[model samples]
Target: MLSQFMVLFGFFALVLVSIVWINKAVRMFDRLIGDGQPAWVFVEFTALTLPGVIGVVLPIAAFAAAVYVVNRLSSESELTVMQATGYSPLRLARPVLVFGVIVAVMMSLLAHYLIPGSLSQLRLRQDEVSRNISAKLLSDGEFLHPAPGITFYIREITQTGELRDVFLSDRRDPEAPVTYTSSRAYLVQEGGGTRLVMVSGLAQNIGADQNRLFTTYFDDFSYDISSLVSRDVVNLDEVAFANTLEMLRDPEAVATRTGTTYGTVMSQTHGRITAALLCVIAALVGFCTLLVGAHSRFGVWRQVLLAFGLLVGIKIVESIVVAPVLLNGALWPLLYLPVLLGLVLSGLLLSIASHPGVWRRLMGRGRRSAEVAS
Candidate 1:
């Protein structure tokens, strides 16, 4: 049972992560490619995002694997055979609980290390890419919008680093939009700033009266374009980029760095712990939900559906229960409500399974009510 659960969980996690990663990769492709970045940069950005994606879907995959393994065993009568050999529900659950723990460990590793490290690297790479001026402005024969309200184009470049046939549109000041055309342009750096120097250029703009076009011809012109492509790398201050242990050690430091309150920092710390614990709850709940039904050749599909609903319900409860933690950090322990609820529900299911007569009588009562209504 443990082997089956692991195999299915691996497959499910792979499929779910791929679906989500591809969807995000599309947006990454547009941003990187539009900025003249290479294909490898886009790939790296998408790859760095995978750990978080895996963390998000790991619990669901574990639950599906558990439900599938349990339902299949029931359909094959292996579950019944085991019961005939005096296997109590709890005893039968031993392998499933071990599988849940394995999944929980994987989630914990992701939450604690992989996700935070990946996010930090991703932010660093993004800052480097943003500050790559040549990549942002060096594309020839293609109009580039490096910043909003500005368009730049270069027809060709010489082997000696001279720009040819440059066309620039500056609509940043909409009331006085201007266009500059030059036969030759050179990128110059002086006083720790970059500028575009155009030789033999004509600048056109609307006249003050707004009734006629005005053009000014110059032998040399300098335009400051450093603002277009050079931006300071914003600090990576998100709660997700910080390790949970760091937050626990000094919540005030994390709160100040991330620009969040003490309650929000504590919420994030406990949220990571609860996220890993959710994997255990999901797996155990799925297995125990199926165990509540007797083995049947027809399959316990109803139980499988019920288990899925309960898993979703647990997630909903997780979000709802965490609201208070965000308000008061001392209430962080309440974040475990979803896990506790799932365990209690699993225990109830096991108790019902251990007593067949109780389940039968409940089913009997349900049937009598339906018959009376008919």
Candidate 2:
């Protein structure tokens, strides 16, 4: 059973991850390709995103695999045969527990190690790509808006990399809209930033208050292009980039370094730990829920819905607890409520499955009472 669960878990994980990753990759592909980036860059970005996706979907896949394997076995009467052989529900659950533990280990590796590393690398790559302004702005004969309220157009580019017939419109300051035109422009690098040096350019400013125009001509002027294409500075000391150990060991230092509060750092750290335990809860809940049902030739769709509802209940508890925990570091233990609820629910299901005859007797007595009343 453990082997079967492992195989189906792998299959479900692959299918789900591919579906989600492709959706995200499609949007990223358009953005990167539209910006004149290469195919390899898109591939690299998509690859870096896979660890985070897998971390989210692995527990779900584990639950699905357990539910499916048990449903198939029940439909085939294999579970009935095992019960006839004196195998208890608790005995049957041993393999499922093992499978859940294995998946929890995988989730642990991702939550503590792989996800943070990949996120940090992705941020670094994004920083480098965002600052590459020449690729986005150097195209000639087309109007480009690098940032909101800024329009730029270049008529031609020389073999020596000089831009000709430059047109720039800066409406960022709505009260004083400005436009600049120049016969030629040269890109200059100074102080680790790129500047457009326009020779013999005319600057036009329109005052919205008085509806008046002002024009000025200069032999040379410098325009800042780096600021237009640059993104928010990536926080090198982001708390999420650190492992859970580092955060827990010195939360004060981590909070100070990342410019965040102790509550936020502690929440992020404990959140990872609870997330791993959720995999175990999900699998146990799924298997135990299905085991509560009797033998049926048709299917156990009702039990499936019940299992889903239980999972949703767990999520509701999680959503209710997370906010307070995030606001107050002392409430960090609230994050484990979901896992505890899941385990308690799973145990109840197993107990009901073990003594299935008691429920049938109670139902029969109720029917007799109903018939007498009628």
Candidate 3:
């Protein structure tokens, strides 16, 4: 159990760190979009969607860690002692299978429920930020003050994408509408508010939608726009936010009706179930490998390679199986068969490897007892 726990713990930690680093690297490309936002903003955005990242990386890491720990134990002669004490491969592997079951359930929860909900929230927040009329949208060299409740201006935009020559108008209160114009402007976000600073501008008020337009200009203008309600209105049912109970209650309804090909759905479902089962498969494979001679130089490395190879093979098979299912709805459940087969095979192999010596010793003892009785 300790060995199994260490393997699972180490794998989870490594995968989490790797995911964070990968997220950072992936976000660097966002800077090229020239959104005038700091790279850290993109990083934070990625961080908010990390549950999906965890779902993808956890199974691979678990498989690798299982092989690694088992190999380490085999190399150190600990596995040999356990085997001699009549601890069959199945007995040693039991902890790993147990761990796998736990992880599988957790991952299932994450993939089908938690990740989708979190992603929905992240998307909603992103939409809100993008739609917000703030300093981020201001550009230079454009006559921006087009109408009431609007202000716009432009200057020679810097290569770094900063705004200059900002203008603004506010008709939010029809009774006392205000307008301000400036030669230069900068945007700042603080305390849940977005503010624009205009230099060398003016302020005035014009009549509402009438010929009586009164305008006054100012040398400098400063205004604040609340960064609230920027999010696009979305219906909860349209978003993917089903929890486990919800999914179980209505699995068919939980699936999106985007006219997805049967093959694609099959593939996706297969991938999800396979990922969950990998924990059990990895544990069984590791336990069987541990039954080899402790002093063997290459045994551990061989098992590690085998485990990785099997994992890759499973992924490839899943992709292949899912392709047909995407084209035809009939093949959806078939995708799960490979994962089930892998688990069964691993269990059987572990059982055989763990007890070869035990059976031989028991048979010898039985023969000796029979001869004494005769």
- Find the candidate with the highest TM-score and give its number: 1
Clashes by residue pair, model 1? none
Candidate 1 local lDDT, 116-166, one digit each (tens): 999999989988888776677778899988889999999997888798999
Name the top lDDT candidate.
2
The order of the candidates by lDDT, greatest first, is 2, 1, 3
CA RMSD, predictions in order:
3.8, 4.2, 10.2
Comparison by lDDT, 1 against 2, better one: 2
TM-score of each: 0.85, 0.82, 0.66
Which is superior by lDDT, 1 or 3?
Answer: 1
Q: Write the per-residue lDDT of candidate 2 for residues 1-374, one digit (tens) a residue.
A: 99999999999999999999999999999999877677999999999999999999998999999999999899888988998999999999999999999999999999999999999999999888877887677778799998899999999989998889999999988988899999999988889899999988999999888899999999999998878875677777988898788898899899898998888898899889988898899999999999987777778999999998998889789888888877888888888889989989999899899998898798799999999999
**lDDT (C-alpha) at residue 248 in model 2:** 83
